[model samples]
Target: MASNIHYQRADYESGLDENSPLITGLTGRKPELKSRDGTASAMATFGLGFSIMWAQALIRWFASPTEFQPAPILGPDVIEPWRLVSLRIFEALSVGVLLAHIWYCVLVPAFPYLRNFKATDEPHQFTLDGRHVLGGLVALCADGFLNCHQYIFMWNANSINRGVWAKFLPFHNHLSSSRYGESLLWGPPMYVYFCAGFGILGCNMAKPLRKRFPDLSNAGIFTIIWCIEFVMDFVIENLAIRITHGYGYAKTYRPLTLFPEQVHQFPIYESVFVASLGLVFTAMRLKAYDTGRSPVEAGFEIWHPSLQGTVRTFAVIGFSAGAVLIFYHLPLNWLGVIGDCYADMPSYMKPGPVE
Candidate 1:
C-alpha cells in the first residue's frame, strides 16, 4: 500500500508542469529558478537605498556652498543648520531611491531576468511581477494609515513637530513645508525601500530556520521574523534619532523606552509594532508568489486578457495596502495614542517649531 501511494505521488508530480501556476499553487511548490542567497539580495537592496543617500549628499556637498555642521551633544532645541542639511540630504536620497525602485519595476517586464536579482527563486510572472510592486504600495498605504492618527493627535496637540526644516525644505510655506507634509511626500518611498530590503531579509532568515527545525510551524517562523524586525527597527531608529536629531519620541511611556528622559527618546513599542510592517510585507509577497494570486485578486481570471493586467495591478496594491493597514498601522496607531502619551513630559524632549 505504501509503495502504491509513493508511485501514485511520483506519477502525479511528473504529470504537472513545474512552471505552471496552477500546479505550483495546488501542490505547494516553489518555482524552479536560479537565485542568489536571500541575505545577499536583501543587503544589496538595502545598500542601494543608502547608496542613493551617499550619492546625493556627495553631490550636494560639492554643488552647494553648504558645509557639514557637527551635531551638538546636548541636542538642538530647534532645527539647527546641521540638522536641516541632514534632513534635506536624507529626504532627497529617499526620493531618489523611490524613483530608482520604480524604474526597476518598470524594467522588470522587459527584463524578466531581474527576478534573479531579487531575493526570491520564483519565476517571474508573465508580465510585471506584482510581488516587487507590492512592497512599496503597502508602505505607502501604511504611512497614510498611521499618519491619519498622528496628524489628528500628535501634530494637532504639538506633541510632535518636524523640527525646523519645515520652512526650509524646497516648497517654503506650502503644505509640503510641514514635517508631516514632508513625511507624506517622502516617507512612503523611504518605507518602501526599507520594507523591500528588510522584508526579503526576513524571508531569507526563515529558510535556514525551517531547514534546521522541520517541525517549526508558520507562527513560530513569523515570531522569529518579528523579533529580528524589532531589533532592526530599534537599531535604525536610535541611529537616526541620535545622529541627525531629526525627531524624537517625547510622549512615550517611560518604562517602555530607552533614554526616555533624553532628547533622543526611543520608544520600545515603536519598534515592537512597526517591525510588523516588514514581516507582513514579506508574508504577503511570499504568499502571493506561492499561490499565484493574491486574496484580493481572486476574481482576476474573469477579466479579459487586455484588462486583466490593469486589474491585477490594482489588486496587488489594494491587497498589500489593506494588509498593512490591518497588520501594522492599526496596532501601531492604538499604541501611539494610548501607550506613548504622558502629560508631564519634559519640555526639552518635546520638539520645538522648525524655525
Candidate 2:
C-alpha cells in the first residue's frame, strides 16, 4: 500500500528512526520531538504532581484546623505601637529594594558588564546571559509560592499562631480563600532579594574555601552554601520575629526549639528546612549561568525559536516550584502538623481571631 507520509532529514538527526512504531503511529501530524535525556522532564512532572497533592492536603487541613490551640487566657497584644511603625518602615524599604532590582535587570542588557554584579557570579563565572535573569525571576516566583505554605502551616496552625501584618497591607486579614494572600504579596520579592545577596556571599566565600581545600567536591561546596543559608535564615527569621512581632512558632515543640524557655522561641528545624529552599534556588541559578540553559530547558530546542524563550521561562518556573515543594514545603509542614498545642502562650504571641 502506497502511503502519503513524509519524513525529514531532521527526524534522523533528532535520533528518531523513521520506521519506528512511535513515529509511524503519528500518521498525519508532525511528530513533536523531546530531548533524549528525560531526567529533567520526568522530575518536573513528578514534582508538579506531588505539589498539587501537597496543596490539596494543605487545603483540607486548613478547612478543619487542628493540632494547635489559642491561649485560653489572652494577655496583651505582643505587637506594640512602635513595632507597627517599624513594620511599616521595613515594608517601605522592601519596596525600594525591589525597585532597585528591577532597575538592575532593566540595565543589564545595555551595560553588559553589570552581569558580573549578579549574585551568582563566581570568580570563574560564565558570560552572563538572559537565562541568569530568567533563573532569578523564576526563583523569585517559586520562593513566593514556597513561602505561602507558612500561612497554612505556621500562621494558621493555631488561633494564637496567626501572622500580624501592618493594616496598610491589603491582604492582612484576607484568609477566606487560600490563606496565602499576605505571603504571596510579600514573600517573593523579600526572599529573592535576600537570596541573591546570599548567593553572592556563598560564591565569594567559596573562593577562600576552595583554595584552602583544593580537593573539595561540588557537593562539599553546596554543603557550605547550605550552612551559609541556614545561618542567614536563622538570624533574619529571629530578628523579624522579635522586631515586628509579625508571627511566632507558638505551637512548636519546646524541647526541639532554640530557646525552649522563651515565650517567642524559634524552632531549630525551621532554619534547616528553609535553608534548603535557598540552596536549591541558588544551585539552579548557578547551573543555568554555567550551562547557559536551565536543567528543565533541556528539551526546549524542539520548539520554534520565538516560542523557545517563553517555553523555557515556564519550564524554569515549574522546575523551581517543584523543587520548592519537595525541599521546603514538605519538611516544614510535616513538623508543623506534629507541633504541640501550647496553652501558656503570651497574649501578644496569641493571635485570637482571623480578623
Candidate 3:
C-alpha cells in the first residue's frame, strides 16, 4: 500500500532519505522531499536519559548513600528570623536559574516561533534532528532531576553551607537531594516529558492516528498527541510517586515532605507544564512555517531572540517550578515538621545555643 506521505529513493550524496520510515512532518525542516534520515538515529538518543538518572543515583547511592538522606536534628528553630527570609530568597533564585537550563534546551531548536519579524533569515534555520532530541534529554536530567546545584553545599547536618550565601537552599533543605526514593521520583518528570512529549508524539504514535482517521492533518495529529501526553504524564507520575514513596495507601512519604497537600498535587502541575511547553513550541514553529518564513539557510546570524519570547518562556517555567516551592514551604513557614527535612531540622544541626 502506498503511504500517505510521499517517499523518495535514498539520496546518498546529500545525506537524506525521504524513503526512510522517519520522514517527519513536525515543525521546520522542509525541502519538498528531504529524508528525515533513519529513525534509528533519533530513537537511539532516548532512554539514555533514564540511564543517566539512575547512574547518578547509583553513584550517589554507593559512594554517598546517606548523603541523599536528611541531616540529623538541629537546634530547634534557632537559625533566627532574618536568616530564614534570606534562605528563602536564595533558594527561589536557585530554582529560577535551574529552570532556565531546562527552558533553553527544549525551546532553542524550536526557536523559530519566537521570531517577531517574519523575514527570511537563512543563517538561523531551526530544525529538530537527532542532536536536539538527545541534547534535550540530557538537559532535563541536569536541571529537572539533579536539583541543578543543590549538591554544591550539601555536607553534614551541622554545617551544610559554610559560605555566607550557602545558607539558603542547603542540600538538606530539599527532599529529592536527600532521599533515594525521592530522587527516583524526580527522574521521571523529564524522562516522561521528553519520551511522551517528543518521542512518542512526533514519532511512534503520529503515524497510526493519521492512518486510522485518514482526515487528520499535521495540526490535528499534534493536538491529539498534546492531549494524550498531558493525560499520560499526570496519571503515570502520580502512580510512580505514590508507589516509590510508600507502595501502599498510607502517609508513608507524606511525612517525608514539608507540605503533604502540595506534594500530592505536584504530579498534576508538572504534567501541565510539560504539555503546554511542547505545544507552545509546536504552535510557534507551525506559525512560522505557515507564514512562509524559512530559517537561516546559510551563515550564522547575530542570534538575537525577541523579548516577548524570553519573558513568555520564563513565565511558563517559573510558574511550573515556583508553584511547587511556594506550596511546599507555606506550611514550613508556619508550623514545620520536626525532623521532616533540613528546612525543619531538629536540635544539634544548628550551631547556635542548644535546646
Candidate 4:
C-alpha cells in the first residue's frame, strides 16, 4: 500500500487538481492553472491543499483548550503530552512551506540573473526529489536557531502565545503567578501558521491543465480562500474557548499572550505573505505541471503532495517570532506607517505580581 501510494500516486493530476469551472467566472477564461518557470514537479497542485491542512492539524489537535474567562500560569503552557513535540512538528512542516515560498518567489524570478542555472529541464526539474526534503530541513535548522534570540530579552519584543522561540529556550517562570504564559498553544503564532500554510498551498498547488482547477491567476480565488480560513480558525478558537469553559481562553495577559494586541498581526502577516507569494508565483512563472526534466539533484522520490515525500515541517516558528519582532519595530520606528503592534512591559499586566 505504501509503495503504491508513494510511487504510483505521484501522477499528473488533471491540470494538477483543477476540476470543472465555467468561463463565466472572474477571469473570463477557461478553467486552467497557468504554467510557469519554477513549478514544483512532485506536488499535485490539488494535493498540496490537503498538505497545508495537514500542517495545521498538528497545531490544532495538540493545542491546549482555551478558557472563556481570563487565565494565567507560570512556566510554559503546554497542552499536556503534546508539548514540544507538536511545536517541533509544526516547525518542520512550516519550514517546508517556507522553502517552497522562497523558491517560487525568489529563485525562479531571479534565475535569469544567475549564470549557473537555467529554467528546470526534463524529469529532474519537474519531479520531486531529495532537494525538496533538504530545503525544508535546512530551513528548520536555520530558522529554529535564530529564534534563540528571544530567550535573552523576552520582554523587549512582540511575541506569540506559545511561540517557537520561547518553547525552544524553556521559558523561565520568575513570579509563577505573574509571568502568566502557556508554552504550547496560543493565538497569534497559530494564526500565522494557518496563513503560511494556506498561502503555500495556494501558491504551489495549482494545476497547469485547463479545467482541472480554477485559474491560479485569479486573485478572487485566493481572497475568498483566505477569508474562509480566517473565519474557520476564529470559529474553532471560539469553540475551544467554549469546550474548556473559561480555563482554555486567554483574556488578559500575564506571560501567556492573548488577543486584541496579538490579533492585529493576524491580518497583517497573512495579507503580506499571500500578496508576496502571489506576486512571486506569477512573476516567476511557476508551473503547476511538471517540467519532466533532470537536474543535478532530484527532488525526494516520495509521493507527498508537498515538495518532498516526507511531511517534515520546521520553518514557521522562526519566521513568526521574527516577523512580530521586526514588524513591531519597522512601523513604529522608521516607517511610522503603522501603529502599535506589541504589548508593553510585563509590569503592565495586572491581576498578578509585576517586576
Per-residue lDDT over 32-118 for candidate 3, one digit per residue giving the tens place of the 0 to 100 score: 224332222222223333334435644554454344343443434354445444434433543453354344444443554434445
**Lowest-scoring 10 consecutive residues by lDDT in candidate 1?**
152-161
State the C-alpha lDDT per candidate.
0.51, 0.52, 0.37, 0.32
Which 10 consecutive residues of model 3 have the lowest summed lDDT? 293-302
* Model 1 lDDT per residue over 116-226, tens place: 665554544533233445535443533433333332112211212222222222223343212332243345564565566566667788889889888999899989888
TM-score of each: 0.57, 0.61, 0.33, 0.30
For candidate 4, which ten residues in a row score worst on lDDT? 151-160
* Model 2: per-residue Cα lDDT at residue 43: 41
lDDT of 1 at 308: 62
What candidate 4 gets wrong by more than 4 Å, as runs, is 1-134, 141-288, 292-355
Q: What value of lDDT does candidate 2 attain over all alpha carbons? A: 0.52
Report residue 51 deviation for candidate 3 (angstroms): 20
lDDT score of residue 212 within candidate 2: 86
TM-score of 4: 0.30
On a 0 to 100 scale, what is the lDDT of residue 110 in model 4? 40
**lDDT for 76 (candidate 2):** 50
Model 4 scores what on Cα lDDT?
Answer: 0.32
**TM-score, structure 1 vs. true:** 0.57
